[model samples]
Target: MKKDENLKKVAIAAPQLHRHKVKLKIGNWKKHFDFNYVNTIIALALNDFDDKIFFYINGYLITSNNLYLVVQTTEKSAEEMVTKIENQIINLLKTNPQKLKENRSEVSIIADDENLFYAARKPLFKIYPLENDHLIKLITGQKVTLPYFDRDLEHLKNRIRNHPFCSAINYLGGIGPVKVTLFKDQIDPEI
Candidate 1:
């Protein structure tokens, strides 16, 4: 086999995890949350990718519908995917089929492999193991009074800062588990 042909084969055989996080936020609703409309929007966004991508969607109900989505496609850059999705969402909103003229939505790329690396380096929060003394105090019902309380709190804070990585992620939402593929090493051992 020719050297160039061999290289092409190797590249084709390798797994490509081109993961991207897209956040979709819809705002300005006077009445109820329209779950159907949001669902339709998500479906429409994914339609462009067809079967070329693997994706997970997590929806948050705040003042508006906040969707955090992770899409992995072997063939396209994150930017291309985001642009397509943004255009689809904007066009749909412009139609205003629901007659909610005031309603507006925004779609953005939150992270790709590169920036997610930097984000992983930062600690969301840290956990410190409870000391034997603290456990004993809690078990014995020590008086919850000033100096001891203040000292314990300060001590706990110090431990967390000193050993930030001792803590692992407590929860993994929809994107959390699958999106970890973008940075496998960032996954904490404890989790």
Candidate 2:
């Protein structure tokens, strides 16, 4: 798949510019679902939402890594953005060809600026309720500061590339060693 020149720039600017982030857990990683298909639908919906908003696979989590769509909003509140995004995704899924089930999603705020996915910060272990189920156990079981590891961005990109859906769509910037996909509002949008 050919890379869109405009989107390339958005990918680079995503981490630093998009401060207000909302992590979306569309489906369960433990259970089987057409990831590419679902993500494509979600991506299309996001593309229709806003151009500056960015989307990516939360591959940092060691478990239950779900699709994360982060929107950079200057006017709208985070709660409002999350609700709109969820609603947009739901509306799109209504016409899905395969009757995609499991709409139970966890949408929350990434309050940490040191987060790898949200910020240009080093890819480290930042626990979220949806992805890391054993976070509480990790906190209680260990005495140290959760043993956070400094993950290489390249390594994370490689891991994402290995996924079967890496080459699924151009919008999925994870395709072939990329990080995130920015659906520019000015582009040939979808929903």
Angstrom error at residue 172, model 2: 13
Residue runs of model 2 more than 4 Å from their true location after superposition: 1-18, 27-33, 50-64, 100-154, 160-191
Residue lDDT tens for model 1, 1-191: 77877664434555564544334344333122255555555445445343445443211111124433444555355556555555565554444434332234733332232332233221211222222343222212222235435776556445423421211121221221111223222332221
**Cα-based lDDT at residue 24, candidate 1:** 37
Error of 2 at 38 (Å): 1.7
Candidates in order have lDDT scores of 0.36, 0.37
On lDDT, the candidate that comes out on top is 2
Best by TM-score: 2
- Candidate 2: tens digits of C-alpha lDDT, residues 1-191: 55675465534443533233334444332232354555565555555554544433222212234543333354345455555555665555444434222444633332331231222111212323333323211211211132555355334444534544332223443343323333433222111
Off by over 4 Å in 1: 1-15, 27-35, 52-63, 75-78, 91-96, 102-191
Clashes of each: 0, 0
